[model samples]
Target chain A: MTFALLARCGRTGRIGLAIASEDLCTGAVFAHALRSNTGGSVTLGGSPGRNNTLACNLLAQGYAPARVLQELRANDPQCESRQIAVIDRHGRVAAHTGEALTRSALHRIEPGFAVLAGAAVKPSLVEALVQSFTASAALELDERLLKALESAAAECATPPRSVGIVAFGNQDYSDVDLRVDLHGDAIRELRRTYDEYQPFAAYYLERGKHPRQAIPQREFADMLYAGRSGNTR
Target chain B: MTYSIVARCPRTGRFGVGTATFSIACGRRNESVRANVGISKSQAFYDRATDPLVLNLLAQGYTPQYALGVLEAQDPDFQYRQLGIIDRAGTIGVHTGRDIGPWAGHAIGPQCVAFGNGLAGPQVVEGILGGFMAEPDAALEDRLLRAIEGGRDAGGQASNGQPRPERSAWLCVVDRGEHPLLDLRVDLHDRAVSQLRRVFEACDRGHLRVDTR
Candidate 1:
């Protein structure tokens, strides 16, 4: 019903996750990120919201990704029906796929990233996700995660209805949090949204941190337009 | 309390709305948009239900004027509300009630309508239309974004002798799907329009990398 990729940027230590699902608001329910410099978690299948919160709390408490998964499996009564993925601050990853899931359920873990899928998602889709993510190592964490999700969605039998991507930078808040809660073609919409949001990420960071000196948005747009016109000449 | 633009893209048949205000979460209570149907917005002494109701009526094949009429007939506080509607065919309807206060007005253009209350002046609506029409070949989302920026540049909302900061802003566009093609918002910020601009620009640049540790 859902597929996701979680990864950490080797250079910046930023952790991010991208997910798509047939269900509505998958990002709101399944994805959780700890504060800046910490790791993140995603919980799918049964009791996702509670499991995700517990995982994040554990990650915040300095527990390793493997230890977080162990804690979840030991405490959750319905762990057999759940799929969980955790990535720690050091880019180490761990994942769990329950036996109660369908035969297609699977996951793959690499050095700095992990890919997981719930029931109805084929193993081939997971493979595509891993390959896509691994091949895009030179890109930013957000783009790498999104490209992996896009590749998996392209291989999926049914198109997803919702998609979300989140990346935590050095700030206390997420650097990028884009979600298409519901759409007939959620992955495409998410891509479009992500593309449109890319240029201003640093600008927003600047404005958030230094409100007085940063120029206005209209002024920024004018500057860009002027610069483009100048270059053409 | 807010200035907004509701429009239908002639080239793509997409519907879009952009709004900015002195309040927080202005988009949550002010916008109702359905793909391949129409777009609606309610502001001033805003009612959250008016937008969806107008969109519902448009989906049922009613005219934008008829939808406005329905709202006027049903709501006892209609006089305090400002509303705008654009149907799938690009027909637009707008109302600025008597009780909406100073600088309340609206402007109707080729395929869109700009409306607001508690604004700086009529220039705000005029600037919105001007900005939208300036870029005929741009994407609907981009055009709507510029339209709101134009409004902000023209003056935006004001009270007493001072201009009020745009505390919140939102841009939404819908294509042929049940959900929106793009829904971006900046809430509870002093310079929400600029913040929204940054978000919109980031969507295009695709270069948001994490800072080095």
Candidate 2:
């Protein structure tokens, strides 16, 4: 049950999420960010579920990182197995990995880069993945997300027998942004899949043909809606 | 006991070999024999020393014959050593030294070469190479194993089936490509070549286990 989350936060724009797991598709219970790049958040997979609705409200209310962390820890039922990576509009990023994650798991933290890679990875993977995206030389959010996946592959404790990558933004679009999956040679498979989708970004913009598959209704519609309707409204 | 090998698979257009004889600078001694040829096996008894290097060098562009020639020339007492080669066209070639211990010989066939020294007779290398060439369509790993079995049947090692512990044994092969698709090693094992083959199979299957989650 490896979990991950990646988002793009534009100062005056949107905050979105893209995540994938080794079990069911993440669409089941993944939550989108609220307007102002803060608010409710939840991502559930299988028997274990992760949510932070209260923490999002506190963050929106301008709570500090340390406070948010403390709030999260206080509510965590299985602190040792949980993991999280959060990046706010201000570029404030926070992460956590439960000790319960597999022993091979490792998290790396750098100024603009954070990485968590391992088998049975915990919440810490979010931090490392986001960091890799932030530090990559990719030109766009999509490219950054792809790079993060590559970084994860390079640092994975045991080479993932399979792999994938996903990304989302608060932009009000009618289509999904990214999705990748592989059954054989994850590195090569993901890279190829990413290439296939690359044209969608520009092609959609050029021919006005946005792909219907790219959009995740919850994040695209709700997240962008809240972001656009300022608190004053 | 220093061991060095350099060979090529003519049919597959691939070349490589690696050898080590429990001594420091073993690679250097083997290197002199290998010269600018295919590859030199100058290390502890590790698998892939010769095959990986051969495949890599072939990818870098070196003929099968020239590659084997370099290593052969370097060994002053060529008769006492072991060597094998398979050219780009699957032309097999090999030479085991007369000075080589009790069991030293080589076998050449349509597209395979097999040779070994120190326990057994020329029949060992001949049997393996003949069996390998006869089954040209077999999987690479399977063919390699068959060759090993042939060597064993021809009085493998000096152990005489006594299960004498050995520090090392090795096996290597090349895909029909520029780079070696697999390189495995077991410094110590009851059947180094066999174990190396198992690891190769695992790597091949690793990609097939996908996680759609």
Candidate 3:
């Protein structure tokens, strides 16, 4: 019913997650990121909403990804129905797919990222996500996450109802947070939205921090629409 | 160069504007909303000040048509401007300046006015109206988002046998307070309207927040 990837960018120390689900508003319930850049976490299946926050809190307290997973399994009575993934600030990755998940449920833990899918997701989809993320090391963290998600979504048997991607940079807030809460073609829509947002990612970060110094949004649009360099300032 | 929709939700008395353009920041200079008063969008050789002025006029109990008349009488460059104005009473006024360029037009719908200049065709504005009217029972922000997406899908800005992409887009909705209920902008993007939709969805689901300040 849900698939997710949690990753930390080795180059920039940014942590992010991309997720899709047959359920509605999956990102709102499953995706969690620590503002302090401690790491990112995603919990799918039963009791995800609560465990997601708990994982983030433990990560913020300097718990390793494995230790965080252990705590989650120990505390939750229905851990067998849940799938969890955590990526710490050090780029360490850990994931769990409970025995009660669908037979196709699978997970892959790579160098700096973890991929987890449960109930209706195939092992091939997990492989595709990891492969795409690993091959796109040159791209930005958000781009890699999106690309990986796109790849995995393409392999899905049925289109998801909702999809979300989030990335936290040096700032306290998420640098990139895009989602399609309920769409027939959520992954495609998410990809289109991400492409449209990529150019403004840095501009938004600048505006968030130094709004007075940054060019006004309107002026910036005017410059870009005119085919002039918007970065001239 | 731009397409815009300015609307007042009759049920909630909320005002909103959805706009996109080949130019950047279409909402910043083009859109204005005054909570209980009305909403205005001034584009096509736009004067950023005009939107607030129109809203101020609406706040003072002037009709949207009268406000347009005031702008026509006062602004020397009025011939180069396009505008869509809607009052709290759901009264609508729109102008597509003759000098704004080819395919410029506007469509007045129930509680909404869609207008654009340098568009692919008249269908762009019509598409906006259709999209807004398509979902009357939907949330105001969702309707506005769909309206702009409608415009983009109907062929947005004009091109030379090539597809013209919207580089910037914005959607804003204001209710009772001095602050807006929703304000999202894509300062620059190839698929500006689509990006705006993404942001709107995130904000709608509480996954993202737009700094109103």
Q: How does residue A4 of candidate 2 score in lDDT? A: 49
Model 2, stretches more than 4 Å misplaced?
Answer: A1-117, A121-233, B1-81, B91-93, B159-173, B176-179, B191-213
Which pairs clash in the backbone of model 3? Answer: A221-B24, A221-B25, A222-B24
Fnat per model, in the order shown = 0.00, 0.00, 0.00
lDDT, candidate 3, A70-124, per-residue tens: 9999999898888888888899998898998767788888899888888778778
Error of 1 at B166 (Å): 12
Interface DockQ per candidate: 0.03, 0.01, 0.04
- Estimate how well candidate 1 is docked, as a DockQ score: 0.03
Candidate 3: lDDT of A23?
69
The C-alpha TM-scores of every prediction are: 0.53, 0.38, 0.53
State which candidate, 2 or 3, has the greater DockQ: 3
Q: Which ten residues in a row have the lowest lDDT in candidate 2 chain B?
A: B22-31
Best by TM-score: 1
Best by DockQ: 3
Q: For residues A183-204, what per-residue lDDT tens digits would candidate 1 score against the true structure?
A: 6788887786676456545654
TM-score of chain A of each: 0.88, 0.59, 0.87
